[model samples]
Target: MADRLRSIAFAIFFYGLSVPIVLGTPVAALLGTSFMRGYCIAWARLGVWSARHILGIRMRVEGQRAAGPALYPAKHQAMLETMAIAAMLDAPAIVMKRELARIPLWGWAARRYGVIVVDRAANARALRQMMREAQAALGEGRSVLIFPEGTRVAPGETPPVRSGFAGLYRALALPVVPIALDSGQVWPRRGPKRPGTVTFRFGAPIAPGLARADIEARVHAGINALEP
Candidate 1:
């Protein structure tokens, strides 16, 4: 119960901070400058700090950052990583579901600040389109972030890694930076939240020249080492 309260309080606090970030991005954009991008990332990192200090959730990051301007393929455990890393890493252009673009203010805020939406329901067509968009962004020197698992897993359950991500690796041929986490235990799907420790294992970058299978293997191996 106490952890749930803490979670609620922290959520409220971050929501309070997010309002300013949403407003600031546009205000800055109106000022005829690109300052909002940095502000957006700064606000994201602050939100991450609040998750730790305010909510008592801790994150442990491992491995070295090898994918600068590369594809960041992560093991999806919860929404926390989605938000937290959006701040911790460089102003990487995000690839998320197209549905989010319909969210009230959040969609606008994220889109204006470099969020790229991929329609998950489009099946093979979605794959074809997303690659084109992702490649264009990466070519412009942006890092790509993707959840190879495709969907969130229940706590303690392992899901088959969808081939979409592997397909992405083969196509991009960019170094893969794998980030793993144990967040589901502390964060309930539809119930109260707990203040458990989560770890982000960042495997070394799969160098640009490595074989695609070898690179994907290394990424999966790193995630396998993480605790549930």
Candidate 2:
């Protein structure tokens, strides 16, 4: 109970303090995209820092991040990985839902930070748009991080990989690096915080050009390998 309260308090404090800076992202973007990236990294690290001190949750990143341009398909088991991945990757641009891009200050910041937004319900046009944006981000030397499950699930559950991930992989023709973690065991989808170390393990990059089935199978296997 006390841990939960502390987590809540820290969230409130973080968001409250971030509003002004997030709202200012547009101005920062005018100077350079690096400015916005720096701002985002700082905010994400703050969350990680607070989670450690206040919630007593530690993070351990195993294996080195793959070099060069690649698409990162990570398991989505909790909300913590979003910020954790952002802080860990180099100039990462996340692919998030379009609706989230309308959330006032956060939306503004996301745009400034060069994050790509996709309309899940839209037709072929939306897919093309997302591909274009993602390709552009990759061209800029930013790793594109996407969650193939499309939504959070329980730690042991394995949902089918969304078609969008396959589409992006085929279009970009970049290596796909699967990231696995067990954040749900600590910062569960719903419940009090549990104190423990969340491990983020980055698997080897699977080169492109393989059949979609092979890629998906590899991704699923890689992401599910969270424990020894």
| Leading candidate by TM-score | 2
Residues 201-228 of candidate 1: C-alpha lDDT, one tens digit per residue:
7777676656656665777666655754
For each candidate, what TM-score against the reference?
0.84, 0.93
Question: What are the candidates' C-alpha RMSDs?
Answer: 2.7, 1.7
lDDT: which candidate is best?
2
List candidate 1 stretches off by more than 4 Å. Answer: 31-34, 123-126, 207-218
Weakest 10 consecutive residues, lDDT, candidate 2? 14-23
Q: In every candidate, how many clashes are there?
A: 0, 0
* lDDT, candidate 2, at 78: 81
True-vs-predicted CA distance for residue 204, candidate 2, Å: 1.5
Error of 1 at 52 (Å): 1.7
The clash tally of candidate 1 reads 0
Kindly give the stretch of ten consecutive residues in candidate 1 with the minimal lDDT sum. 28-37
lDDT of 2: 0.85
